[model samples]
Target: MSQHAEQAAAFVLHSRPYRETSLLVDLFTLEHGRISVVARGARRSGSARRFTLQPFQALHVSWAGRHELKNLSQAEVPQVMAPLVGKALLCGLYANELLQRLLQPADPHPRLYLYYTYLIQELQQSADLEGALRTFERQLLENLGYGIGFSHCHPGCYYQYDTQQGMIEVTADRGCYTGTDLLAIAEDRYETVDVRRAAKRLMREALAPLLGVKPLKSRELFIKTRRTA
Candidate 1:
């Protein structure tokens, strides 16, 4: 019995050479979380499949096979992001790494796909790198089911974010709270350094519980490695 295949709108999250003439592609689809597809003979110079599978571009793709590694039939970029230079390029790669690491194959996350597209656009156009990344990280966390709690609290009852327990209302002496921190986040008031730092800390803490002890190497490299001209 031959199994049928379907086309999907996707983006190339990452790709690497497979054997001699093939390529292993990690893709994010509008319907699938992260999928691994093999582009046979894509490594040959001047192959249209090779040129079409670059990251940060929207692609229409078709693949077949019931196994984990599907055989890719076609890929074409429908929308192209403007060229990202310098740190922006590295940042884009970091985003792809995060998706590759955190998302499981075959699970669908349509909303996350939209958020990812928006993040790429923002990174391509923005001058404030930190703000753009911070925003995307927040969205990523929420989509992964580890959303942060930044709601307002009573004068004495504070909401402390525990990496293990999530957001909890605790006594002021035992926990931490800034009045309406969650409300501010909900309202999109992420302008100040304090707000951004708070969001980053919350997301990192939440991610710790899920991502285990493995640190994101791309983020570390971004901080430690110097960019070349």
Candidate 2:
């Protein structure tokens, strides 16, 4: 039994070298979830796919296979995609890494795919890049069924996520999320530094267990670049 997809919406999650000149590409697709495919001779000088196949690029792809890894027959840019640079570029990579690490292969997550596309678009022009990422992270967690609570609390109160007890309201703010900040973060109102920091920490806490012991390379890279810059 063979399977085939034609001109399906997709984004390249990661691409790495294979035997000789080929590329083993991981793709997140609207119709088919995460998949791995070999882009034959993509390293050749004239292979335009070498340019088209990359992170944050919107693509329409055609693939066929019977086994897990598919044969990518065609990949084309669906439209003009504005390139993401600097912080936005890094954010795009982080999103890709999250999807690669957390999402299972061959499982369709249409809503998550849509959220991912919107996140890429938002990162392009968002004044608050971290806000955009936090929004995406929240959506990612919800889509994966690890929904974190950020509602129904006092304005000045603080809270934290507890696996055994859900959202636990706490007194001290040192390691807890303030109700005001939580509301703002939940609504994407990243106006204050306090709110932004709280959102970042909350996301880290929620993602830590799912991500396991291994640290995200994206976080390390972001920290290193900020220090040097």
Top lDDT model: 2
Candidate 1, residue 69: Cα displacement in angstroms equals 0.6
**Model 1 misplacement above 4 A:** 152-158, 170-177, 226-229
The local distance difference test score of model 1 is: 0.78
Give the per-residue lDDT digits (tens) of candidate 1, residues 1-229.
Answer: 9778868999888889999999999999997678999999999988877777788878899999999999998887776667776688888888898888889889888988887887788778866676677667778888888777555444344577777666778766533655455555555567787667666666666677777778888777777767532
Look at candidate 1 and give me any clashing residue pairs: 150-182, 151-182
Q: How accurate is candidate 2 locally (lDDT)?
A: 0.85
Clash count (model 1, backbone only) = 2
Scored by CA lDDT, what does every candidate get?
0.78, 0.85
Best by TM-score: 2
Measured against the true structure, the TM-scores of the candidates, in listed sequence, are 0.87, 0.92
In candidate 2, what are the lDDT values of residues 1-229, reduced to their tens digit? 5565544799999998889999899999998899999899998889998988877888899888877888899998878688888999889889999999999988888998998888888888755678778988998988889978666766878788786565788887668777888888778788898988888888888888899999889889999999999
